[model samples]
Target: MGIAELRAESKTASESTAALLRELVAHLGENRTQLREEWIRRITEGRLLTAMSKDEIFAEATSVYDSYVEALETRTLEALQAYAQNLSERIIPRGVETHEVVGIVLLLRDVLARSLFSKYHADSRLLNAVLDAYEPAANAIAITVAVGFVRERERIIRQQQEAIRELSTPVLQVRERLLILPIIGLIDPLRARQLTEQLLRGVRANRAKLVVIDITGVAAMDATVANHLVLTVEAARLLGARVIVTGLSPEIAQTLVNIGVDLGKMNTVGDLQGGIEEAERLLGYKVVPIAEPMPA
Candidate 1:
């Protein structure tokens, strides 16, 4: 396809993909509600049926529940398969537009039995039956045509995150004056340790008086994570660099308090802007309204 045609096609595919996802979400939600209600009803009925008979009532109730679960599983499998087939046909009418076809196929592959089972594990037999049908449905949903789409998405996300992390971890701006470091993803011990090393090296190498450690992208930090942060601050102090912690989420602050992490010695700020202001103050500089002329 020509560039304009390709762009148009891409836009169309993107819109369709979003629409399909919404439809799939709605379908799954409806099915999930149905499954939960059925399971609840069956379990409630089974509990009431118990006559305190140690053997007969228990066995009968178990069997009845199992039968009901199996029937439900069969219905779910048929419905999902029908849905997948319908979506596939709609996206790829005559000759498959390779990109759009792949996207639709991947939608089926990414939704797996393990996830569904996690949601509906009240009945093992039903879960197994769903898996049995899900496998065939996924295979038949023309996944072969777009098998790499999911992988491509995963790869793109990974690359973008890595780039953001790199951006967050700042390099030296000026000698013994400024430094930046970014913490990306979850703040775990391993990542924290790595970040600590990066900060220490960057600070020492650049002779940074102020080091900014940004954690805006971090999901959460456990006690171990908190310890790593403390260690990094201590290490930076030893290197004669003031550590400026940025991106202090209220939830993270609460987590630190709950974990008994007293960030007393290290300076904490709301964001990079606050950190910059604090850094300027610490350096005995002020943001004046007018730029002062240099005395020759």
Candidate 2:
């Protein structure tokens, strides 16, 4: 065929695909009730969404079914993406996992594909054309939903991790230009790095001049984490903050020693109270003893 004839053929094919999709959407809408119920039944049989009660599952299924159909019909995913994010927020807190969310979408896709096959089986040519138009849209919709849920889940997970990091490594302002960080529990490289970050942020936020890090609650520390502690001290010094480390375990002290870390750099104290007192002293806070009279 000539170029003009080829162009006309392509336009006709595009319109024909759009018409097939419109018919597919209408058929799905007409059979929404039976198809959705069948999908729900399959979900129940598969033991998915067990975190939700039957009514909860049914309600969410209805919303998801409508969104799924809308996505396929419109060939757009913004509405479906928003719905998936909202659904993830609701269901994730109820212990719904990524696999469960993906599972139900695939199940719905399967159910709808089977229904389409049964509807168009008598006409082989039309069946092939319908399937050709439907499968790509169906796959795209499923990917959009699954991706939305995963992104939301990842965001929530990061939020929770930040909260945990704050709780685990607490940097408190003891006095003007003085802050204390009481680190408890095991210090892996990740936690140690988080500790460094929290301390640095606190120092900058408080404009802290002297910092006391108490690791009494810490059971042990490896050489790598000890290096992180040393690096933190160096970082603080560069930021115009002096670091005092307290509650050093024997193993950790030895690890620091073996690593040839300069004790002058770390400025170790025996305990949290001593570290605070030293911090206060360094900040020019003097303690005046007050004596009580025997008789007034």
Candidate 3:
């Protein structure tokens, strides 16, 4: 064929593909409820979406279905990505797994393709063109959704890790120039590093001269933990903050002694109250209870 004829044929094919996609989008919009119900049914029967209630499933399916139709109409992945990010934010905290999210997207593709094939089986050429256009668009949308979901999930995980780090090693200022860090759980090397960072930051922030590390809630201590504690005390001293180690259980004390980890230069207290008292004494303050006013 001549170049002009070939160009014309290509333009016609392009127009045809665009028209078919619009038709598919229209069909999806018109039959949304039916398609969503089928999608939900398939997802419910599958392994991934068993925990979700029907209402939850239907709501999410409706959102995804409508977004997918919009994406097809616009021939862009933006709608799908926005919908996926919103869905991920809602569902990840609800305990929906990543694979489950991807599974639901695949299920939508399956249902739509099946419905399309059933309606257009008589016209092979048109059916082929529609499928060719639809499959890639659907797959691309699914991939975009999955990517968005995964990125959001990763962000949530990072946030959770930061929160846990803060919770695991909280430094509190109980009085002027006095700070207390109550270590309630097992301290590993990583946590020890986090604790040291928090302690130093807290000391600087509070202008603390004394830091009381109360370990009353600690369950156990090993050589590594002992080493971490010793390092923390030494670091605090370097920062000009005197460290008081308190609430050392008999077991932990023996463990520390057996490991030959010496904390002799650091102040020692029997309990949290003792630590507080010592901190106050070092700061030259005493908590004197005020007498209550006589009843009227």
TM per candidate: 0.39, 0.85, 0.78
Kindly provide the TM-score of model 3 when superposed on the true structure, using C-alpha atoms: 0.78
C-alpha RMSD (angstroms) for model 2: 6.9
39-151 in candidate 2: lDDT tens per residue? Answer: 99999999999999999999999999999888767766778888988998988889998899999999999999999899999999999999987877777778878888899
The C-alpha stretches of model 1 lying farther than 4 A from their native spots are 1-176, 285-296
Summarize candidate 1's per-residue lDDT along 90-191 as a digit string, tens digits: 333333344544432343244334456675589887556555544443443334334333344455567777676556555646424788676667665655
For candidate 1, the 10 contiguous residues with the lowest summed lDDT are 67-76
Q: Rank the candidates by TM-score, best first.
A: 2, 3, 1
Clash pairs for candidate 1 = 168-182, 169-181, 169-182, 170-180, 170-181, 176-207
lDDT of 3 by residue, 122-216 (tens): 99998898897788778787888888889999999999987998898789988888999999887777888888899999999889889999998
Worst 10 residues of 3 by lDDT: 287-296
lDDT of 1: 0.55
